[model samples]
Target: MHNDDLSRFFSENMAVDGELSFQQWEGKVLDFAQRVSRGNCKGLALVSSGGTSVPLEMNAVRFVTNFSTGSRGAGLVEDLVVREWACILLHSESAQLPFRRVMDNMDTERFFTELMAPEKSSAVASIVGTYSKYKTRLLLVPYRTVVDYLYLLRLITVAVCHRAECLRTMPMVLLAAAAVSDYFIPRTLLSEHKISSNDGMTVHFSCVPKVLNVLSDIWHTADCDVSRLFVTFKLETHDEMLETKALKNLTLYNCDLVVANKLQEYKERVVMYWRDTPGSPTVLQRPPNGSIESLIVDCILRRIECDATGGGRS
Candidate 1:
């Protein structure tokens, strides 16, 4: 694409809801990128979580959103952080947060009530240590709208892909688990103020372009010899179509792996479609009384470690 075409593509595709917040969040991302450059963090993982919203009006009295709760992605962040990987968690403001889910049950008032309980002591100490050790390593970059999510994702993804090639010695990973919106009311189509129900309504929205293609190309070139392991999730409501859609994404986006699961079985099992492996892919199952986090984390770490050692794509 020519320079003019490239510029026009972005402008017409994603229009921001709040320009100020987008710019402010971008500054934060730049600072994070600078920090990564100077740190000795062995690996860098950018994990996106939650669902994105589309504003119906400029003031946004009403909007559209997906059904994602962000549990899987947030869990992934916790697993990586616990293993000491430098993490950038780009999550929705309403989504689940790493460690906080556990701490939410360990409320401060409830804690003080049982302040000296021996059982609570261990759990309390663990939480304190996790926060203390990971405060500097795990950075949270939250988003509210689809526009904010896309803009921030582009900024961080491009920054990492561009910089990793030049200076990174450790492996980099991009895990996009967000259930992004495929349709949205463009800025030009949105009303300046909320529409009143007195008129009853019909709205026109446009398809939102996916940015995975750009990231894959940016990080895949021979000139950019950055070792990376990219993974994405595919959630399907239809059991029969799960594998088919996952396979399609695995090829279309050129991802290293795609975690495909039906909504009913999402928490219990995830079928992984491998890009490097030839025949069938692996199905990671949670035992009758097991934690799926361990299984998921183990699979990801195995792939990431392989690429890091193999010196490039694995």
Candidate 2:
């Protein structure tokens, strides 16, 4: 979008106070703004979950999708909420939720088959009940298409970027684990009707614009404040390519940290690379007594705490 268009876009979205999701999101941002203005609340986060789909037809019967169960993102939300952090969860419409699905099925490997057991009924009910009671703490916004995700992300990113009006500025963290599509057929070139299989068609693909540079530079709580921290995840199956791609992402996107994980061993291990740390990367192993998800949550929380204390330098 052009400069005027982007400015108008932000203005139009910032005016949306009646929408329930926007209201919930705005409430968290506004509260954090107030608290940070008084040096009270410290951490605020925006999390994106699930994979984005690229529609191949204007009618939208079929589409190309990316690979993601959204389990990691959902788990992050669950842990962050229980730790009393304000989070905005932007997830796919078809994705599993943190408390409702992830909590009910603690055995992530086996899926929800355990919940089908008669002995687990009460435990499941208790978790759902608790979520329903405190659901207001989470601002869940669902997006199906890639376009929808990008638009909503732009809106939320701009909305939370208010000027730090006091001595303290709240630490804003972006934990983007969503699997977005690499290429798609633009809407203008999409077929209006379904193509017949008898006539084989060769589809053309175009690159989807990566917005991390725009995010790091334009999306901020204040001008030249350096208060926002971005943490991105890199998944690769090729062992030789993992470190190169992860480090490339950090440099290319201008993010604060890049997590490199092999697709096969992601759940068991991950290496965290800090932007300012020039030497050894932190190698995190999943605890035998606990899960890797919990360990990651703790690491992120500690980083946020450090950022809040050091005026957003962590």
Top candidate by TM-score: 1
**What is the total number of backbone clashes in candidate 2?**
0
* Lowest lDDT block of 10, candidate 2: 10-19
lDDT digits (tens) for residues 1-314 of candidate 1: 23344345557645454544566765566577667657767677889999999889888899889757788887888778778778889999988888776656566887566566656566667877787777677889898788678777876776666644433565677888998998887777788897998987988888776777666665554243446777888888997698788888878888888888888888998888888772487888888866675687788787767665675533
Those runs of model 1 whose alpha carbons end farther than 4 Å from true positions after fitting are: 1-10, 13-17, 24-27, 34-40, 105-121, 164-167, 222-226, 288-290, 311-314
Please list all clashing residue pairs in model 2, or write none if there are none: none
Per-candidate TM equals 0.86, 0.79
Name the TM-score of candidate 2.
0.79
Note the clash tally of each candidate.
0, 0
List where candidate 2 sits over 4 angstroms from the true fold. Answer: 1-42, 103-122, 129-133, 163-168, 220-227, 311-314
Q: List the residue pairs that clash in candidate 1.
A: none
